[model samples]
Target chain A: MILVADSGSSKCDWVLINNHGEWVDKIKTEGLNPLLLSKKNISNTIDKVQHLLNKKHDSTIDKIYFYGAGCGSSGSGNLIKDLLYTTFNQAKYIRVEEDIIAAVHATTQEPGVICILGTGANCCYFDGRRVIQKTPALGYLLADEGSGNYFGREVIKSYYLKKLPLDLEESFEKEFGADLNLLLQKLHNVDSPNKYLASFATFIFKHRQHPFIENMLHQGIAKFIDSYLLNYKEELLDSPIHFVGSIAYYAQDVIKKSLDERGFIVKSFIKKPVGHLVNNIINKNIL
Target chain B: MILVADSGSSKCDWVLINNHGEWVDKIKTEGLNPLLLSKKNISNTIDKVQHLLNKKHDSTIDKIYFYGAGCGSSGSGNLIKDLLYTTFNQAKYIRVEEDIIAAVHATTQEPGVICILGTGANCCYFDGRRVIQKTPALGYLLADEGSGNYFGREVIKSYYLKKLPLDLEESFEKEFGADLNLLLQKLHNVDSPNKYLASFATFIFKHRQHPFIENMLHQGIAKFIDSYLLNYKEELLDSPIHFVGSIAYYAQDVIKKSLDERGFIVKSFIKKPVGHLVNNIINKNIL
Candidate 1:
């Protein structure tokens, strides 16, 4: 048995596979960023799932591959690796990689720009086997770019600024609230401002028909491309650009329009890259 | 003696105007927005400034006109008034009004649009004597269209998203650290996200020469105009639009461009309305 995991700021997706590459079980746990959690916290979080696997599966666990947002940095990656080692001591092997790498492996087998436009945004120059060149995503605060959080920030800004059209504002007020107090409480006084902000992207998608929102969305997407995707301009013109994230999937039309206008070839835009990632793991015959 | 105050989310500007309408003293203290502070907290905050007046001035405090962000609403205004009355119980007259009214009185003596684009945004149709018609400004979270916090949010979004060009990014990093952790800590874990966010507007003003930043400022100001100024279009065409806020004062070019493009006349723009507010109290020939 093997375990594969991808973790973002909001949640983690986990899959259990048998020796024959057949699905066994899939379980989701709260997001665990090693940088944000203590070693004990990480251990306790994983301990919650220990009983579900049973002794037999736990002992037979062949490998654990975990990819997460903050794990891209060496210090945080090693911290998670150590934490997983303690949690899955029975496993034969353990590997930790950045979520962007998972995105790269999941989306492409040839050289191209691989973009992750989910809760956060990241783009890497994938040369089939690995990321050769990349633009650093400063994180959601400084640069999620075209990610859900990016769009969410815009939505919140527009909503707070009352720039949303009257009809859209009415709908938003009905859905959210008509005041900043609620938003301020949720965003600043609560945990996970990223998730709080990202949640509004759905509202934007729902009201994309509004010229204000459409222009805002276009500007956000255009900004992402200009700041992230456009970094790979030379290679982008030659190879197909691929996106893997919920924001990209739901806003495909907008994304496609952006790409089309920019004259870039989009190979694939997938909502959930886990299936493709799992396929890559099985097809590559990696332990 | 009289004290005229204009308080926003961050700080309070207090000016001592004698019965003769001459300036006597000026004191600034931490912000005292009644909506956010408890009664006890509000009293404690005012207690800090009680001694600043001295025994003579304290005894002679005939009136206090407190104009603050959250004071317009009856409940909050009464709470602050009660708090102040307790603090300066010797005072003969005490009044609490919304900050928007101060902006109106400070800049205009005739019917026109009065805008408060400070940490938040608000506009009112002051029919000389009182607000005959007004647009509801839903605070910073829901509707500070062209305020410092509004522009500040954009600066932060772009800074974190790395949407800032290389040169500006370097400057931003040099001034405010390169990571989002610092920003997140300041904005969430600490207190006052509004102030933390609004603080970035200074950065925007400093780098307004950058094309990216210039465009952002323009967009923000334009949004404010479209949403707030445009609401009173018929009146705006005939009457002068008066702005009172740090954002409007510093980014006067952008604000003027927005107004010019719309064919609206800007009567006056002041960074701090305390001078005008005090002048209004003195020159109005009434309490």
Candidate 2:
């Protein structure tokens, strides 16, 4: 059996397949970014599913392919590889790759830009083979343009700055308290600020029809396009662009409209890229 | 003995005054923002100063006029007042006012737009006597436009986004690590994210002469002016717009130029408002 995983800052999707590419099992665990978590924490996240991973599926796991956020750097990738060695002791082949690579495989087989707008945000230009990102994924603080946390932070600011419409403000207050004390929890003490901030994005989507939300989405998409897509420039126009994340899937209308206005062609948006990634890897015969 | 205090999110300045409006002793303490701090923590901060407050200054403390950040709301003001009473048991009178009032008192007694660019940011229109704020003084997370944390966050982004010059990037890497894990600690587990972020603002100031830093400052100042100063509109042009807090004092040239270009008259900047506030209150006979 071969185990393939695609993880973002919020959640990870794990799937097992036979040598013939037939589905064996599918499982999900909370996000385990090697950079954000300790070796023990990362090990434990996988350990929690040991029963499903090793018990029910009694076959020896020959190979493990892990693609995750925060694994863009070789240091973090090596760290996660080391941690995985301890978990999948039976696996002879273990490969760790950045989440952007998974996004590229899931979205396209041609040269193009791949953008991930999940709990965190990231983008890369694929030269039909390797990923090239001019800007680093600086996490939720310094970057994350049109990602979930990005909109979440903006929505929160709107709520507090009194920029939100009356009804939306009331809804936000009810969902999340109208107090700084509660908001400070996300800023200071929260274990995962990205997930915490991204959780607020739900409020925006729930009220997506509101004029306030629509305008906010348009502005956010425009910003993402300007910041990331524009950087790719001449090469960008030739190849198809694809998105792989919840933010992109849900905000498709706004994103599509904005990109259309700017004359950028968007090929597809894969909400949960795991299936496509698994298929893409299987078809490439990498396993 | 009368005690007058002016505080931002980072530091609090305290001054002792006699009935005849003469300075007795001056003391400084870490910031005690009532909104961010628990009652126990707030009381503990005061308790640490009890020895200096009572033993060194051997006199009955009669009143306390505290002007501080996070005290804009009546609830937090009352909370701080309650905490103050627990510390200064001998005090006969206690008054808790928002920090913007301190800026107004320290800068001008006449009607003007009082802007605070401190550890946090705030602006209020002091109509000769009463302070009028069309918007709430939302704390660091959502607002704090032209403040230390604001500029500091921007500086951190520039560093991570590789937008900073090579020298400044090296300086930033030395001061605050080049790694994301270290940055994650700030976003997740920081006790005071405001101060942590504001610490990066020093890098900007140290390299203020650099074209990049200057440009960043210009853009930041423009954003601040657009977000805050513009809200005051016609009254802002007529009034002698005054500023208080360290950020305002340090960024005066940029601020003045921006405001001047926009034709707004900036009168003065009070770096530490404690002494000025004491004098202003002393003369006003508010005690």
List TM-score (chain A only) for every prediction: 0.93, 0.96
lDDT score for candidate 2 against the true structure:
0.82
Indicate the DockQ of the complex predicted as candidate 1: 0.17
A12-69 in candidate 1: lDDT tens per residue? 8888888888878788886666644556767776776555676436447768888887
Model 1, span B1-287: residue lDDT tens = 88888898788999888767899999998777765555776788788777777643644787898989877667678889988988887888998988888888888889889887788888888877778443565655445666787778777666654467888888888888866544554554334556777888888888877889889888888878877777787777678988898878888888887788778888888888888778777888645
Clashes of 2: 0
Instruction: Please compute DockQ, using alpha carbons, for every candidate against the native two-chain complex.
Output: 0.17, 0.34
Indicate the worst ten consecutive residues by lDDT in candidate 2 chain A: A182-191
Can you write out model 2's per-residue Cα lDDT over A102-183, one digit (the tens) per residue?
8988988889989988898888898887778877777775567788988988898787666788999899889998876556
- Docking tier of model 1: it is incorrect
Query: Which portion of correct inter-chain contacts appears in model 2?
Result: 0.38
